[model samples]
Target: MRLYAIGDIHGQLDKLLEAHDRIQTEAGHDAVIAHVGDLIDRGPDSRGVVEHLMRGRDAGRNWIVVRGNHDRFLPAFLERPDWIDPGLSSGQHWIDHPGLGAAQTLASYGVDPGLDREALLREVRRAVPPDHARFLATLPLWHLHPLALVVHAGIRPGVGLLDQAEQDLVWIRQGFLDSDADFGPLVVHGHTALDSAAHHGNRLNLDGGAGYGRPLCAAVIEPRGAHLLTGKGRVPLVPEMTG
Candidate 1:
């Protein structure tokens, strides 16, 4: 089966939609689409993004969404408004990064962000659809395929897939990014942003900084390797490579 891996969306619903359109056109109806999470925060339409994906899954589309650091914030904040420990919920640190875009998310649900914390919490709890919360709660930390290992962030350099920590799968950087160690399966991931898809010998970084005002990307992977799905069309991950 053909596999299409989408990079970090981070609430850029427009970009997400555009990327999916391209995927559908290029990968055909039977392709499995894997999302590298971070579906919320840092953009204008987190709610829309979640809802769109939910609708697609409900329609029997083959879609998989992995858990992301920003995605965890919603549940944590919903469970406990004070769950803000800079490292935990983005809500606690929203002030430091207004780009968390919580207000836009609230706005999407018709809840006023100006309400008191408790009142806003109540409104948000009441406003957000239960299915959306369930969707976020049920996301897997990683998706493993024979040809590709997909995760939100990168994996721990030397850890076996079964033994890898969830934290590292969704949040790691240095060790995974800097290491050139073979990861068995070709790693397809999106936590670290880049100008475009970057292909290391062992892994491919697909995050094009969608939430940071760049295009959302989808990498089409075959047994041979991967290609970036662009507006013009599919392009090889490594331009110089030839089959």
Candidate 2:
């Protein structure tokens, strides 16, 4: 199967659609498109994103999404939440996970570390509907396929995959990106979208930070390596619609 891995599509629905259309046309046949998460939060149409993915909830549709740290942080606030002001980037995880490193981890795609994080955090949570919330809540921290091991962020250095911690898989980065560690399989990631899918042996990054108005990226990966997919347009990134 020709696999396509997508980077972050924060809410650029139009770009996502364009990317999808391109995938259908370019890939053809039965190409699987997988997302590395952070589907909402920055751009607009967070709801639209959720709806689009939710519609693909049946068999035959080759779509898989893993939850990024951004996706999980808000929900962590909701689940094991500490009373955030419904306004700031103030959270236990945000505070606790201090070693996360380099604000612009996904810099290749114009992920501004300067984005009003507090506001962004608040807005992102408010936009997620119950259905999407449930979906987010249930998302797997990692995706293991025959040819790929997909995770929102990357995995730890020395820890075995089965023995790796969930927090590291979903939130940690420095240890994953800095070390010469090799995951058993080719790990395709989305959290740290550096330049061109930084690959060191067994790990690849595809997150283009679509939420930050860069481009929604996807990759076509097989045992032979991976291919890239990107789309254009803004998707009318407005603020606060419904859920």
List the candidate 1 regions with Cα displacement exceeding 4 Å: 85-96, 239-243
Candidate lDDT (C-alpha), each: 0.82, 0.63
lDDT of 1 by residue, 137-198 (tens): 78999998877888999899777888988788888887888887778888888888888888
Alpha-carbon lDDT of model 1 = 0.82
Residue 66 error, candidate 2, Å = 1.0
Task: Give a tens-digit lDDT track for model 2, residues 160-192.
Answer: 778888778766767676655546777778776
**Stretch of 10 with least lDDT, candidate 2:** 234-243
lDDT of 2 at 19: 74
Residue 189 of model 2: what lDDT?
81
